[model samples]
Target: MPLSFFSGGGETGDLVRSYDWTSTSLGAAESWPQSLRTTVSTLLLSPVPIVLLWGEDGIMIYNDAYSVFAGGRHPRLLGSKVREGWPEVADFNDNVMRVGLAGGTLAYKDQELTLYRHGRPEQVWMNLDYSPVLDEEGEPAGVLCILAETTERVAAERRRAEAEAAVRESEGRFRALVNASSDVVYRMSPDWTEMRRLDGRGFLADTEEPSVLWIERYIFPEDRPRVRAAIDEAVGTRRAFELEHRVRRMDGSAGWTFSRAIPVLDGGGRVVEWFGAASDITERRNAEAALAELNATLEVRVAERTAELQRAEEALRQSQKLEAIGQLTGGVAHDFNNLLTVIKSSTDLLKRPDLAPERRERYVAAISDTVDRAARLTGQLLAFARRQALKPEVFAVCDSVRALFDMIGTLTGSRIRIMTRLPPAPCFVSADPSQFDTALVNMAVNARDAMDGEGELTISVGAVDQIPALRAHPAVPGAFVAVSIADTGSGIPRDRLEQIFEPFFTTKGVGQGTGLGLSQVIGFAKQSGGEVMVESEVGRGTTFTLYLPRVVDGVRPSDDSAHEPLMDGHGMCVLVVEDNPDVGTFAVQTLSDLGYRTVLAATAEEALTELATDAARFDVVFSDVVMPGMNGIDLAREIRRQHHDLPVLLASGYSHVLAQNGTCGFELLQKPYSVEQLSRLLRKVATWQRRARIMSQ
Candidate 1:
């Protein structure tokens, strides 16, 4: 069947031989009829990626599209058996070609095929078709094959089915999650009135679409403006919104809820839906507020209790201090009484007219000096007890110490070397000038005792901005003028330091110490908003530091100028009410000697009896402070009722308790007074009575 060259044609129209394309296309160049080429080419070049194969004993060559469908197979696979061309698909290809050669058509829609191209992964999905090629005599010749790639469409359909399944499973899980959550999950339109709350039953049916008035009705009135503004802003700006407000319950109780919303935007960026949650935090909020209020109340109570306890402790300390002073004074007065007896006997002997004048003068001077010494002792006791009134002034501490140096030199008994360490700048404190001097003298005496009159004593003064241990002591913090008295002697033991400030607790043996020294220092410091502390070692020495808060502008000095002068009582008759017979007898005798006629009563009843006898005879009534019945002030009022012109003087050992009641207009004198004080007080009362009588006349 080769083409023949004919002699009948001209040179331009030379005869050509017809070439066989059957071997390249259908695996047999002579077997493939020309009519089959057109049909196969048209189908392979269609819109969907398609391939064509024709075969005799193997696959024929296909179009470029067909080669791509095969994916990296050689284009020269013409006349090769389909099994030889792709051995992995050999059985499948053989079966497909056998059915087509047997004149049976085969079709496969959306079949997934996997192929390796150059050892790289390739996946293809195709609609496959195989048909038989017939000869002119109606006999089977070869197989025709067509492939259409459908990978993307098949994958999309599979993903859609999986997504639908996932949605169903997630719906159940999400419902459980929302139900278990403490917050109330919800969906709403942009208007916020149409809220679909998601409970165990999907969303609330009533709120599928609600009118704006529904939101207004549910919202708290006070929160309406803010909630409205937030909604408006969120809708206008297409942004998320949040708010916290109280919601009224069906039972009329209000509870707080915090709500938040996130807007779901459409493709045009307009809010289409809102997803939000609200939490019921009413109990938590209420509990927090209540706890805060309770904490504040507790804090205030604690502060008050602490202050009250401090006041009670201070009162106890004062009481203990007074008791110790009383005991010390009582014992010392007994000893001094004995000494006074001897001194009085010697002075009496000297008072004789036959005695030598010089010897008498010496004896008289010694008596005067001893009396002065006794006065000084009583003054010290009063100072330590804080019973004496102070005349406070802002004075330089340096001057006070310097003035006391000479006195300290004499007091230290010439055995201790006195040293002074004064600050370069003036350190000032507010206190009575005389009492301040007395305090320093008392400390110096104590130092003398600590050193046993043989060690070095140092008095130092300085101003400090802070004391390190003061706050720990529960003391005030401020500028302080520190006056330190240090003794180089056997130091106070650690355990006895706090006890030293307690009254009557002394380390010194009897007759060697009064123990009022450190107690006075402590009381003075406390009254001045300061404190006292001791630093000591076992064998070294002890330093007693007295801190006094410094005043910036200085306190005004007190005037003691109003004190009246002493007078002899020669013209007055006095009524004395004393509960104790010994004290009454002593007062009667003392007043009789002072030239005052005395009427004595052992009790308030006896005094009332005497007053009933002759009320006008008494110019003044002097009564004991404490009594079995009807105290001195009450007795004085009874006496005044009968004798309105009578002047009263109340004598007491318990001066502090009497003064606390604010009973004024009567002269008060502390007990254990001298003969001189009695005479002077009587004269003042007599003078007052005479003046009153003159005014009435």
Candidate 2:
């Protein structure tokens, strides 16, 4: 039978049968050996690349895989000997066949071969294995070959090898660069206990040992704990570590260094080691220390200079004060001497019995007038000294200025034009209404004199939110009512502007001015919790501004309560406490004149003892604010606690006791008061006591 009858009838099987193999040494397929027929059928049916060479000629019979591997020479080379089919690699195939026919086996991994598969010689790589086939007698009969192409895989391996070579060369260059740098480069174990220097020298180069603690030896003793903590933190967090600290240098000298490092993690994200660098910063640290020391020294010098300047300023102030005192003494002595001469001459004239009644009356009147003038002079001096008692009240500044307009006009006269600019609404201030009027009148008179009794005097009132010029004045910060008096006059000289407020520092000729006007204005303003400022130009004019703290309660406190007709004391008993004998005698006499019975005490203790003896006998207790043993304010407090019904009146003439401990809720009666003022106060207290007794009954 033909080999076609034994073929499987697939594409490869059909190709085997249709081909004329009778011309070959294998001859007709029907005359082939049974062993050869069986091997041919097996080769044609296999999916892998399989081929068989039969007998001594090595005629090829291959499967579909092998046919594809054969390329364009498949069908023709199928019936040819291996030596003839692969002419380009004929020697290699010849050896393969020779070894197989001798009952030996051969194998090649990625073996190189050349063939004329597509009518052109081509080089290829393959994995090949050849084994001998045996006959029924167990002797080698033919060769069986198995092969797979490995061209793509072999090319990939060659590219990978070239890339690895480039990486190795780059690593060598990186190591060389690190070795050349001045900064130290190092690597540490995962826990940072061991360090290996990559550069020639490291931050710890002073240590010669190769132990794990080699780096620790160079760390400053004080900085070792912090450095070790940082390393442990980096390893724990698997993050970068950085710090600046002092270190011991290789030359056994102290130095500063900035060190930084980052962890190298393994495949499981666990820290494997650390890579780091350190740079010396000893010079920078030394420079910073030197700069700090220099700054401290400069500060000490500046403080010494400031203290010296303050001492010089204080001395200048003292000299100015002494000059002012001398001026005040001269002015007071000159003015008082004139008044004393007039009084002495008038008294001597009145003493002559031969004087006419009218002449004697005129002389008496002259003496009385002299006394009044002296008293007025003393009052002005006290006002300038800020020692005069002020009765402060919440009154509208506009109202006060408006009421004083006619009076101011009378003082300035017809030659001077008095213009008033008052606010439509009342601008209230907490101050003494009488003092406010006096200050305004005093400024008007000054303006009149400056203008030679003929000029425009403008008095304007307004509310001020803040006064920057008066910030250093005694007035507290807040809203204020400013009463400004401006004059179109000859204006004050610039040199005398500051001296104008000093007592008796006037520029007027002898007997023309007392020079206490502006000083009184300043004293009143400061005592009333306010300030006074003057602005004057040599050619233009002068403006005096009085800033008084504004009050929210706009209603003016009425004096009608004190204006009531004075009542006789009706022999009501009075307790008088005075430290001075003369003052006590005067007080007792005044009370007696007011028709009141009086009891005198020298001190607050004596007064308390008097009150304790007969609290009911005394209708009122008039005590001096300052006395030895216990002050009047304390006495008044004790009287209130013991006898709540008794009315206590405090009296002071610039007492330190009143200055230190205010009035202590008792009504204050300023000293040097007239009999009318005393009578009025006593009657008011007596009336209140009578009303209280009536209510209690």
Candidate 3:
């Protein structure tokens, strides 16, 4: 039974002869059965790998090819049992042995198995064919296996199948991306001749047409050249291109689009294809354009609103000016009517043929007093108008207040208690002393009226370093002497405080007050480089503070000549220039009564004619300051030029020209003058002219 009996001269035959098989269940090779020997000889002689399992143990026998398949276990497995040789595939081999010993054949194509080869476990596939080897009597004997390892062929086929599946999945994802996109995705040939494919059909009106034709038709005519140029450039240079252009939509409406593409290049540095996408940007562009238009409209509207606001402010100012003028007219009419009543009554009373001397004297005195009061009233109006001429002098505020206390008490009546708080030292201020006294008296009377005739009126004088409340006042910032008149009386309302300084704005009932008192006080303070402030609350008393700029210089001496006896004109010729005929007659009569020979002229021009006719005829010219044509100041200037020796006196009730041009180097006397006052002014001018003439001679 030794394989030498059925000799074969191959590598497997030599390995079988050298291998020790006595320890195996098949026993020594020479003890092997003849049938097994013949099967081994036949397997050894085969070209493909073949193995034979003999007897009940299914002892292993293999050819050279089979030995190669056995890898590192070949020599040892040559005579071993099949299970012992390939333990990993033992159960499979057992089924093959069982079926083959039953005289049946078993075959498997690409059967999978795990085997120990080269001393390590390996996964392999094989095509196995099993057949039974018969004994001498033709009973079942052994299993003869013909096998081919198909590991490499099967692995290659599996790799090819996986590759195909991956390609399919990748293409599926790509198509999904294209179909789901909002932008139109496209590919074009390298020559830019045609579009290869396109996705996102919803963006196109004619999906069946080529992309180039679609673009030509749907794109705005104006944008065709640029889009064509961009595509050409991308193809020529093999570079990315981007552009934004207008497109005509399917609805025949225009919209905007942004298109971009990158050229695909081949290894030869030639353009292969271009991949591109176009996005709808119509809404964004429209919104931007609308915002620009809205900004322009907003600018125009803002300008219109600003102009309207300016116009409203100008109209308000004009309305306030007109109201002030009406108030001034009303107040002037009321006061003049009152003065006329007194004068008319007195004149009518004097007209009685048998009037008693005492009654006549009393009427004349009443007329004189009323005339003075009227002149004072006109002066107050001028002061409030800022037209009154000021004769400023440095005076002690404390001393002035002290001197006026008794007079203020009398003016307030016995019902009001007068209190004075004067600083220890004199606080000097530069102002017209008379106007200052008038301001004080006006404030006191206002307080008395507010108190309803029974309240304490406290007048306090002090020096202030800084008055924060007067920061906005027109007065220059500096030290000031504050004369505050506070009254324990009904306070002014908060809403009416700002209007209190306006002329004719009053709380007193009609006919009770002229409403010019506080206005005049405010004007006086402002004109004297000062200001007035008031603090009041309902149910609390009001305090009015007059802040006059402090004077650092010595007090000016008072004029003692004011108390001088009245001097007559002594029959000197006088020329009276007045605009009104009745006023001209009154002036002429008044001068004549003052013992002057008077001539009447209704205008400054008429007065100039009279003086030109006989320059030396009139020793003095007394002219009203305001007239139709040339004013009193102009007449005086002409007289001074022609008749240098003549004396000129200018008088006015209220003259804007006088206020603007000042006295013009001439003497000024307030209007509605008493006969005595006229006599005194005429005498003073005549005397001064006489002395000047004597000195010249």
> Highest TM-score: which candidate?
2
lDDT tens digits by residue: candidate 3, 74-146: 6888778888878888898789888998999998999988888977788899999988999888998988889
For model 2, residues 1-697, the per-residue Cα lDDT tens digits are 3455465736777778877888788888888777778888787777889988877888888888888888898777778888887777888888887899999999999997777778787777899989998887888899999898897888778778888887888889878878777777778888777877777775544534344875567688898889889877877777899999888887788999998998887899887788988888888899989989998998999899989998998998788778656666667777988889988999888889899999998988888778766756665676788866666788888877778889889998999998888878888888777778778888888888888888898998888887655435443568898888899888887777777887667776555456788898988877777788888887689998988899876776567756666668889999999989999999999888878999999988888788778789999999887677888888889999999999988887666455444576678887656566788888778778889999999
Show how many residue pairs clash in every candidate, following the order shown.
6, 0, 0
Once fitted onto the true fold, the runs of candidate 1 whose alpha carbons sit more than 4 angstroms away are 1-354, 361-403, 419-438, 451-456, 460-473, 477-482, 488-493, 514-516, 523-530, 537-541, 547-570, 580-597, 608-618, 633-646, 653-666, 679-697
Error of 2 at 650 (Å): 3.3
lDDT of 2 at 603: 88
| Backbone clashes in model 2 | 0
Candidate 3 or 2, higher TM-score = 2
TM-score-sorted candidate list, best first? 2, 3, 1
List clashing residue pairs in candidate 3.
Answer: none
TM-score of each: 0.46, 0.60, 0.57
Q: Model 3 reaches what TM-score against the true structure? A: 0.57
lDDT of 1 by residue, 1-697 (tens): 6422222222111211132344344433344465455444354345443334454564454545555565566443534567777776677888887787788998999876666655576676779887777766676666667677788998898899999899988998988888788666878877776776675332122333334464654567888888889889988887778888776544557777787899998999777889988777788889989999999999999999999999999999899878766767665766588669868877788868899888888887777767766655655555556554343568888887888789899988877999999978777787666657766887788778778889999898888776557435654567988889999988888887778777666665555456677666665566455677789897899988887777664645653423556554665778889989899999988887767788988889998898888878877898887898888888877767777888998887554445345345676665556665666666667778899999999
